[model samples]
Target chain A: MDRSAIIEQLTEIMIDVFDLDDLEYRDDLSAADVEEWDSLSNIRFMVAVEKAFGFRLSNSEIESLDNVGEMVDLIQQKLA
Target chain B: MTDVLTLPWLLPAPADFRARVRALKSAETVKAADVTTLAAYGLDLSQLGSLGKIVDARREELRAEGRLRPVLLGVAATHTVDLVAEALPATALRHGLLVDTVQTDYGQLAQAVLDPSSSLAAAKPDFVLLALDAASLGLARPQFEAAAAHEAVQSALDYVASLRDGVRTNIGAGVVLHTLATPAESLFGSYDARVPGSVRWLIARFNQRLTEEVVGDSDLLLDVAALAETVGLARWHDPLRWHDAKIPCALDAVPLYADHVARLLASARGLARKCLVLDLDNTLWGGIIGDDGVDGIKLGQGSAKGEAHLAVQSLALDLRRRGVILAVCSKNEEAAALIPFREHDEMVLKEDHISVFVANWTDKATNLKAIAQALNIGTDALVFLDDNPAERERVRQELPEVAVPEVGDEPSDYVRLLSLAGYFEAVAFNDEDRKRADMYQANAQRASALQKVGNLDEYLASLDMECTIAPFDDLGRARIAQLINKSNQFNLTTRRYTEADVAAIQSDPNKFTMQVRLVDRFGDNGMISVVIFDRGLDSWHCDTWLMSCRVLGRRVEEAVLDHVAAAAKAAGATRLTGEYIPTPKNVLVEKHFEKLGFVQTCERDGGGTTWALELADYAAPALPMDIRTTIAFAA
Candidate 1:
């Protein structure tokens, strides 16, 4: 997946998952930006992303995917 | 049977909200069988006058009852907004409320919300329903950016944030703002896109923005979207193409929408807090082991009913995954209870997932309390689910705080009933939740070690009782407060405090306080006890001393006694003394000090016993205890 496309997909997922009305994806945007991105939902988000991208995430991979930039990077690696 | 307290809808509420609330009142039936019928209409403003009249009637009826206090009171304001404002003073005087509407002045609204007279302050409706007009946010084909309207929205948002903090501080007050941002669909033109006009579109936009702004702040948002969906689905599902006139009244849809609103409210409260205290018998699976034999008991994937039971177990396991602690409170022969837990392959929640397992024939409430004490949570957090209603009712009456969901007579709806309760919703997950069961299991192992200790002092010392006492740190504060709330027998002075309270104590230099985490070869007993003190002008007074009952009789008490004695001696105090206030329970420890060699200092008339131990003569017993120490010096 193109990094931008992956970012777009992740943004859409975040919006849907958090029920954000009009979410604008920024590199600094993280789980902290959204209230509904609770610990349980975070795990669910990871599960959903894994299914969507067709790749399993390790503990390190999940931990490292904290910020939007890191998420985009991981997505690029998976797609590559 | 009419819930005269509920605000009558603008459209005549279909006869159903009354019927549904009535059913809830009566034990005759469960939640409405077909709530789909209730979900069929939009908020019809034409009936606003009628709704006002009905509300007046209901308020009068409640006033007549004298005892009926409305959890939430609803009022409709017509074009006469000033009259509505004027009525608030008298309304607050009589019914105790100021209206919760979209404010013309955010400051005034905040003051009103903070004031004791505000409806938000008095009634504390979990959410304030605000009726807004469409023009406020510019409803169009493309949604306008909320940031553009930030100036006006910011004031409301800030006021809301202020109210949020205020509500937390005050009792019977936690006001959440819910905006109904729309006029009427028919008046707004084809703005509805599918339904009718801008009203519907405005409602959707407002709901969307309001939801965003509220974020984690609001308990729940009552949106008109679900009701619109219900109406749309109803219109489409109708076989005969009917005109608007032939369609059901929007009022008829009120009950359905109301129920959806109620469920949403319940969900927002965030899952019925329920530590699942399960009974092991035919309850978890099938068969009475003493009678049917272990192998004969129905279980496994092959048996359909067994599968259903296993499905229930699996649901419980899933609930545990979501942070619900699964505990076993069964009245069975201990060996029989263990058969399935230890031997059965299909058991989803293994022995370890059970945070507290009491297989003895003890009264379940006692066992349940033991579990709550062990877990260091309130009994109210427990939801006792058993196939037997008798068992359920027993616990319900004894531990009334525990939410006992009524499991139906039929086997099939067991899973369905459990799901409806939603007893396992968690805001966050933690390592503590996952390891809770293992901790309890380890405590059980620690219990077995207690049996081997030769004498009280020897046992306390032999297991190498290590006390990790430090000034109450952030990590241990929650567990400490939890100990205060849950600890009973070993608790000298049950001084219940919250996390904030503990932090306040830590900042105060006059008070000497520390929590002790007892650990041994068996396992880690996390924050097992706490003690506090005040060095009085004449003497050093031991304020509070509490240890976990699980770690009691293991010379944990010896550590506490020794610590307090040494502290008193070090302070150059003449004597050390403590007080014990009697409750229905804690009678077990009424004679605790007499056993510990404390002399009676003063005995008040019909109050509780008080004791004092002289620092000069107090000899710290040289017990055969394998002990480690971590005590802090007085500041």
Candidate 2:
């Protein structure tokens, strides 16, 4: 999937899983940007992102992720 | 992506009747009919097969047909003559209204005339029928010697009477009671050797004690079951199939059942059957289609067995014609079952008559689950009919949630079983029941098409989607509550709410409630979603937000945000905020807002993620999916 498409797909999943109606995910969007983005949500988000992008995230890696932009980059690298 | 509705057809039952039952099963109202003859099958055995579900299906059918007539439930006539006078102006219960059946035998015309209350003048019954079996006549147990026994019978009688003549005049909406005598056989079993006089004596004694308790007019009527024995004709297990006998003809010599049902016709409310999930084998016709070829299938016009099935099919067709939904769940090979509907000349039920056909060799319980899923209905709303006790037991064991019936064998007395259960009895008919089958069938087509699209955006774009988000109102209140109870996935803060709860929220101005409806290229996802926001000073909070999983992958979430942001901005709110409360099933969308553009505001102790989006700077992403959005001004 294209990067923007992956970002878009991530956006859809976030709105659906977290149920946030008002959310914006640019490449720079960080953990501080979303209301429902927490540890558990982070785990869920990571799992979902891994599935959607055809990759996996370790506990340490998931715990280290702090923003949407970083996660997007990680997913992009995995895709590359 | 096969539309199950369009799949090959099966069964010998009429298509229309099945359709009507299917339509009513999902109705909001609960319609109840009388089931007099059902007592013969023995409640335990009757409850084992389609009997229970059929009865319940009947109630749903009644509701769907909008035949929710006021009902009058009549109890033992011999025990409570005062039941009628006490039962008048009855109160409506979950089942319907109750009425006292007339106490006096029709032959005692002088007694009916003499007793002021017994006189039809004081006690007008839309229809009066006997409820108890006359078999008790011979067993004439003496008056309750114990207070507890006395209270038991009295309470049962009192409950029956109270239901009939409660202060609530609208108790039995369209139902009525009538006066008639119990036939000798009804009091005595078909095999009973008791003489007629002895039987009458036993019944008279039984009635005398009950009548002495009350001083008012006995507004009750006698039914044919009090006169002659329904014997094998109406009884559930008369092994010697009386080939040439019709219920009218069989009752000609003993008109109690006919007369009572006819009199009750005044209160005859149209009962529609909802969701008739039928089994193929011995229940629908004489033999299994798999074992018995199309030529051998006993449906259409000829033999008694064939005729019996035909009679049931005709009844189902009439119900469907009046608005019932039909479905099939059988254990036979799909190909063999389809042969009857596709090729058999005498088959009454066609492919279109059925809303869903689950023809796999899976257990009936699993099949029923699939059926419920396909119809988007609760398992409690279905009535499964089968001829095998073993299959019924499996369903009862594994899928205890689905209602199975007691009437497994004995297809000959299918009509009588319905009359006895009164589960499908109704007072009137409605448009919803009639159109429901078609609606569900249409839904099947939509579901199949939806499955063909890949990914959420592709699905959304293909839908040619249009969404309307509005606050809770009278029109969508019930739908919103139903979604709260039904929707599993794509539900945020899965707060279950009932109609009353929704009403409470709608009445509270402080709580802002809204719902979303999506209509795509295929059809309307009737109220596919809902959202509730509690507005705070600087920021708005999400009270509840949920959507149907069917519409999940689409950028509809973006549309919801776009709409919410606009509303928040219009309301002068600085920020729009929401939280993600993770439940095991909803992990699929936990990161929803990070993708949307909302910034994290706070995290709760229990792993809750709260995010906020500034109203001034909120911008929607370039959604790859095509989606049309509309906002209904909050009222």
Candidate 3:
């Protein structure tokens, strides 16, 4: 899958985790943008993402990523 | 009566089920599915992504979906118990529970149990679970031959018993007790495992003590130690997690723990499956007995295939000892199927162990119906296990209540797969459990005897039966409450009572509670009857009356009323009044009061008969059987 496709799937997972409605997914959208995406949900969201994508992200990779765009970039680099 | 085959659809087709389980891509999909639907799909522990995260939200979803069967649980842990509390919601969903958990202050099980203002008292949970660990119980690092080690175990048990007694007296909830888990970090190195004095062996005995203590009591023992064994002890606990948060169980192990707890609670509620229906052919042995002769089948001593089948057989035998009836439902020639069980030297399950054996080419759904009829149990109580996926699917579509375990292709995986499903969840173990296999065997004997007799009266007379009627004792109270809570057919008022309620009835000045046990020429049907009657100034009012369906139509009802009339007379009553409240299942007892010659004076407001019998003309009815009766602790 292309990077944009991976980004789209990841965005859908975040929507499910936070139960987001009337929300648009942007490349720069981060945990701070969503009210329900607290630290616990952040871990839960990432775990769901990893499960959906069939990969594991280390703690450093999860912490270092700033936004949805960076997380999508990490996924693309892994697929490469 | 609705036929088992015509039951409404419960599970989807297997391929569709697998597809649905696979399609659970996100938390939204999972939360949307009902608890039973999730369990039917059989998602693995890891397949469910971070169950801890979704546990709370799923509670509301479960309620919204109307899939929530609530089990208000009281949890008093000796250590950190957040993981168990967290895992409970999702894991309990597998067994169909909302799992309303009430937590006590850490290490304050006694205070929580005693204090009326405590959450345990206020929540009034249906069940109480004591989450114990070795370190908290003071047996983590005992000396090899230390006397203090044994004393400490005894003291811990007394402490737990007091808590159970307090709950029984105050709240009337069933207590679920368990022993400390044997840590993976053994103090004595490898060789000392077999030594009786070693910590490992001591821990094993401690677990046995825990189980034995709750054998006849209203309490149940959760086999967390067995759970720890199934999932290796090393994997069950995390040292860092324990150090940081005092969590005894690992995050990953929480789901499995919750599953075990849910099973115990379900069993307590009398929802456990009773019979195990087995398929022959590749299921019982390595090869088909029809093609391969008795000697040709691999089930005995040496090979891995043989050992796997043997393992399954051994588990079946263990299940039988614990009161799970075994029956055969297979698509093979009856004689050929008998060859493996009767003629084969390696067979662990003999013909005597099985309650009903139906071996024919007919579809298993039909055979299962015959087995249920022969055993006189509901189709819901049956657990059909077969290796053929097509046969399994057919049965699932036909009878959804029958628990069809996902026994994979290999014989090696059969035992592990069935054990994980937790179909045969048992509440209490007594002499009755050990004698259950024999009772069913006696049913077969009774059937043959009935066929030979000329009429129903003649058949009942030929049995040479004895009924022992007595007041409630400590030993029989659990079984009494068990029958009161679960017995549907032949129940008079269908009044559900806890063990504490039964205990209260015994202690009350005006109330008289009694239990009846029967033994025929064949075997003892343990505690087949229970009655609670209230003594008024000039009248006796029946509060709760129920008899086990196992002893129905054997003149036990006549004997029960005869005994009650005498007791009512002795207690200075002029008249006896009984009520028959109808439920969907208790239609078998619709004419119960009328049968005893008690006139139905009127019907109650909520649809039940108010029956009255004048004690002036009361006389014991002459039946064809011999009876010995004692009324201990008479009113």
Candidate 4:
């Protein structure tokens, strides 16, 4: 449940939700960068992330996240 | 069939659905059968969305290759229906349907139905689904007065009626209506039932009124309120999701919703299963009946385990009451299997309830096929229930078409799982459905009588069969249409007709239609056969010749042919032509024309053959049944 561990698990979920081959973890990585990541898929991605991290995300928390770094930070804060 | 025991049952849906999807995607060509097998292990919204992508691609490939023609389903909903549409194709695959859905834009259900030039009308779907919610129809709002509430319900129903009539006149599609699910939020808590204008009261009234209005029609009703109540209203409705995405139900419940819709559609298309094949030991009752004596077996009112088994028997009996054929395919000795049915006082399913009973040491897969054969139904029309996982797995491997639900070790779970499977989903029920069990039981009596008599002709003579034949009239139209759709094994040219089509044929002067009913000493077999003959230049062409498989070996077809030939001769036809069209289930009638002295004139490429019988050379076969006819024929 450390930052890198969360990032690693988060990358696996993104890969599954977006059906991507590979993804590099970075703060700049966002929905616009992935072609398959749309509004509908974002809902699925959020659900998968919540399930994987064992935490629920509020509607505002889900909407406010802008990048992989923000999502990782939210997960870390929620876990804390 | 014996080797099925060596093969493993289908693996349960993997814990990691994404991994399974990846594995399926990695294959060179993902087969429809593999996708269907995966779909059979129900999925959640995310899993359904993932699997639906594969189903869509596979459907396109099959349609492009001329291997599939999907049923077009136009979905119009008050909320966003993308998720339901996404889940449909994969869920439909479980019911042997490739559904191509055209979804109307969010909150445009009324516009889609009213506008003649809309995409829903242009696509001309086989079924138009009106997926409405209580909130969308304004039934969720509490009216201050009871009269206002009544007016609200009436207006909502009137609006729905307009939409249904629009779909029928504009698109010519069958309408699928949804019952409004009462919102979880209640104004007065338990006291909501007392208020006429309460959300719960209004929604319940609307649902009841909708159900009453569509009872005797072809409109398919998806009881979403009942479904929501089953899953708990709190779990079924999500306020956050509704506010954000405009989704009708919770995302997790979309798969079940899609499955119910698919079952209704499948039932409408005559794909609902007909029989429930059951195993005895640890299934109907507790403990092995053979090992434990009748008095020793744990089955009656004493213990919790015994009552659980009794519940299973009660469910089977209820299904039989609804015309679903009950059959027994067990591995125990015949006498041991019969002991519980005959001597046990606690048994709910008696010997008379089961249509076909096969108890032997043979493997279940082989015995299941025999049961299907005895019932004259396709193996696909059977749902096998057994407590043993190994036997269930073996049957699943041997007969992939037979539905084998994964009932865990709990006997109580069997009823829930089978009920949720929707295997015996039905759209219509008539008098024939009520008497179906009795008809099949009488068939079993005739079979046992044949064995005792030791001669077929002597058995037929002892039965004292009487045939009442008449032209197709209004009274027998419904049964005639049902027989046309259901009879496959003993059907020549396997042509299906609707009741409307049968009515049209009844009035056509150039066409001759016969509805045949047979009765013997055992019991009355109601309207067992239908024959339609079309007059050609010098011959009477048999457009449809089908008989109930129960009356097959009794030479009912021969007697019907005798009457047909005599009628054709009186109608100034020189020859009678019949065709044998081969379908996967209709192989039993391949040589029907040839055996009836009709010369094979041509054999089509797909194993279909055309035969002709010259009227001058045709001789009526000696029939045991006393023929009674209302139509005139050659003396």
Error of 1 at B106 (Å): 13
TM-score of chain B of each: 0.59, 0.51, 0.82, 0.89
Local accuracy of candidate 3 as per-residue lDDT tens digits, B405-425: 766678887776677778887
Task: Give the candidate number with the greatest DockQ.
Answer: 4
Task: Give the CAPRI rating of model 1.
Answer: incorrect
Model 1 TM-score is: 0.54
DockQ, all candidates in order: 0.01, 0.01, 0.20, 0.44
DockQ score for candidate 2 = 0.01
lDDT of 2 by residue, A1-80 (tens): 57788788888767644535446777777667776565434544554566567765665666677667777777787788
The CAPRI class of candidate 4 is acceptable
Question: Per the 3 Å backbone cut-off, how many clashing residue pairs does candidate 1 have?
Answer: 6
The best-first sequence of candidates by DockQ reads 4, 3, 1, 2
Candidate 4 C-alpha lDDT tens digits along B297-336? 8897989889999999999999999889999999899999
lDDT of each: 0.55, 0.53, 0.75, 0.82
Q: C-alpha displacement of B292 in model 4, angstroms?
A: 3.4
* lDDT-sorted candidate list, best first: 4, 3, 1, 2
lDDT of 1 by residue, B1-635 (tens): 11211222111345444333233333332211111112211112112222222334345443433221223422211111322322222222111121222332332444444566654456544344332323323432333444444334444455445555554454233333445423322443564445422345445545665667663432335455544453454432221111211222232243333333333433333223547888777678877766776678888788787887888788888877765678888888878788887887777768878877788988999998998877666675687878787887787568755766566455556676565434453323445456555566676666666677646656555566566666666776656655665465566766655444677787777777778776676667667778888777557777788776656666666666777667667766778778786653466778887888888888756578888877787788765444454545555
Best by TM-score: 4
Residue B632 in model 2: lDDT: 46
> In terms of lDDT, which candidate is strongest?
4
Give, for candidate 1 chain A, the lowest lDDT window spanning 10 residues: A13-22
